[model samples]
Target: MSVVLDISRLEPRQVLFAPSPLSELAEMLHVLSAPDHHPGLRAWATATATGLSSGLADRLAEADFLWHATRADILLPARPAATLAEELDALDERDDETFVASALEISCMAQYHRGVPQPLISAKDAQEARERAAIRGPRQAAFADRLLTDPRGVRAWLRRLFQDCEREFFADAWHDARTRLYADARHKTELLRRKGLAPALTAISPALQLDDQQQRLVIDKLVDGAGTTSDLGLTCIPTAFGRPHLVTMITPGWRPVIQYPITTPDLPRPMTVNLLQARLEALAHPVRMRMCRALARGSHTTGELAAAHGLTAPEASRHIARLKKAGLITTQRRGRYVGYQLDLNTVARLGSDFLDSLLR
Candidate 1:
């Protein structure tokens, strides 16, 4: 059978009337694959192909094909604002880590797919990252230096990189998709209240529902917003892109935390060791680890993370939740959205300690 036949003639309810970026990519791929097919699709695919490496284009083609056959669900809209607020209140009443874990999972996936670099910070990047660290306090400079010199230390420091990406991607896609679905601001808000992320309006919807804990977490974030502290202890505001906002917070000891005003859309800066530990623990699931490696560059939310990593949102969420529970990262709120960032300090320290033990 032809590859197109692989896609069912009866469109799945999940995809009916919904714009599928993946499908669009696939149609383009099919045209590219068959020279005799529609000339328009072929021309579009060829044009897009010019910007990508052959390997990446082939991977995207495979992804497009897989998406067509799969019945994966998408993120759901937020519940009614009142109910969401109540749910969040209930969540705060309980100290269980489940909701936090879920948030973390989303964050980890986001980071793996979208967060920024904490590599063996080049002398240039290192010097600047360290200078920022000094303003936070005295010990931070040494901490930054240790992270640069040690292999395990650097890896640990950079682990949250993935979570950051996950967070940003989720927010951007959700907002854009939701806005397209409901053009009116008041209606969009109302819809967000009903569904959780963005309300689904289509007759055939693939929107996933949020549990009570998830609902509560979203409520708390929506009302409070999220922000991070720079290495110098100055609060940095989150830019629209998210990851670039937290890039300034690369200090030691003093890591970023989720706070109101939602200044920066990136994750908190935890210890390098914490990040490393989370990554190592998360590595037990190779797929999650692969996702993490990808996010080291910037933030991506659940959907983008899944698309990039070639996994479903739920599957990716599971791995990300595990990373969050390990205290390797944190999440932030952007409008009715969430984003992730690395806990650089904790991860850096953990990495340095591990190296010390190994050398001993």
Candidate 2:
């Protein structure tokens, strides 16, 4: 399925392009929590922030808590808050209720990123959201309560987060990565200036197809949200943290973001115990091993695998998701059926890496 955006009404200038520090910082948090999705990247980030203080590392790893506090909407700047500090400041300035409401929209992720955009909600909606969120767990509601009670705490947290990320690698890394990011921005602008919006988008990703009759840019993006108004246009951001996969996000009252992977694939593979441990730990399961064996037979659907293993579809799906995240399974789609196949090359590499890591 493709999300089709009507760019005919949107001016080329209205379609802004810039690097977002919030996007990068959020990505840093993502890789830490879900390293499987971002192969080789966590290794690079770990190396980049080698000199980080142990206390800071522990605090930074609390990305989920950070997400709960700032709300996903807080991170996507209304203007271009090019730095993390600026984004946090923008969030702190917003009414407490609106901020909490926007965050509740992103408290959970939908399938394949193909979920639809949540409509802008109100302060009363925020209160309702806090109550609903508390059903999942009280911590999120309590977190919002603290933020609402004392906004200064938000400012202080942002200062510390910005300091840690900047001192770690965001500054130098963004500087080093900016050349390619800027070049991409320039190229997309030129396409818009000459060939127009459709060409610029198609050039950005091969999966993009223009349907002039439909008045929308058809994209094979795995995102839930769809469409943005001409006033906000669409923000195109090239990000390092979201490497190897395109990401699309739409939060309440903010411009929609299409954060495509950076062109450069230069994630450094420094020898580290955690990298090896992550791979090894991924296989520490009987069900996953059984699923691996089932997959070895051939590319199969979750239902097919589940039936063969006498597993509930959800149970099989969970195992499959974990194995895939660990870089052991690759996916292929044929018509409506998506098949999962084992990645022998990665499994082989895992063995080699495990041996190599132990020696170090």
Candidate 3:
């Protein structure tokens, strides 16, 4: 006997809450589109003005890279000849506000560096140096003392300090730089007006395509309000595995939003109290919770998860299958192994709602 499945007959509520491998796909998209800045820096800055981390500095560097690359095609003049590494080295050589400013630029560049070793110093060391320097002020003597004790710490501390300075003294300067860049792009377009670039600027098309199934998945996410316009703005391109992916920022509203090729969008909409409760209920199972935590770390095959959890391979598969059905996890086959990863963006939203409810 043959069993026939009718997907179209499924109700919206059923599909929305059902577990499916597609859930993970949605989660990956969310991470890609979220802001590029390190959320940790924002959290730390709000909590303490003095604590510092080299990791945070590195993140700032990567963000700078993104800002630059996103606008690369425009043929704007090069940012002053100084490279991030060169600027850092110069800062290490000097002991003045000029050095601090240079360090800040390096930090911004570090924010965007893909594979470089992050924040040259440990957080504890950076924090201590920040404290000492804050109390002693920006005198060369104090700066020297901090540097001698913890060069990495001193640099990280200075980077954070300079970020505040930039916000104060150079905010307008950065704004003007951006405006000039745009104006230059427009000027170029006007000069080349008869050429196709003007019409190309009108309505941006999807840089990629989605298969019918992927398109339907995206439509469902958008309709359920699980993902916002910003999240779904980019067209999904085909990956090496033939799965759809997106990695470029697409304009949605006034902001340019980055979309991750293999991730889901974390919805910003508030979850209803009932929905929050239901999500928590879904997560309450010990087996499910373990599965969620594991997926958060990265993808794993059923056998690998079973081995890690000390369950029989079939039992582990059953549990994962359940989670997939619940829309809590997703699996992809790679040769002999089917890898599983969490639907992080959805989990994050649900987790945020749970936390908010508790606070309320």
Q: What TM-score would each prediction reach against the true structure?
A: 0.22, 0.62, 0.25
lDDT of candidate 2?
A: 0.63
lDDT per residue as tens, model 2, 70-155: 23655555465656667767766776446544554566322224333232333444465456556656665665555555545754
Considering lDDT, where higher is better, how would the candidates rank from best to worst?
Answer: 2, 3, 1
* Candidate 3 backbone clash number: 34
RMSD to true structure for each model, in Å: 25.4, 10.8, 20.2
**After aligning candidate 1 to the native by TM-score, how far in Å is the CA of 265 from where it should be?**
29
TM-score of 1: 0.22
What lDDT score goes with residue 184 in model 3?
A: 35
lDDT of 1: 0.35
lDDT of 3: 0.38
Error of 1 at 262 (Å): 37
- Please, what's the RMSD in Å of model 2? 10.8
The CA lDDT of each predicted structure is 0.35, 0.63, 0.38
- Per candidate, the number of residue pairs that clash is 73, 12, 34
Select the stronger candidate by TM-score from 2 and 3: 2
What is residue 297's positional error in candidate 3, in angstroms?
Answer: 0.7
Q: 1-360, model 3: which lDDT tens digit per residue?
A: 111112222222221101111112222212222322224224423333233255543443332321222221101111111222333343355444323322222212222223211123344334433454345344533444444456567567655544543444223333333343334334434533444322322211232222244222222111111222322221212111111222222111211222222211442433434445556676777886776777777889988888888999998888887677666777778888779988777776565764343234
Best by lDDT: 2
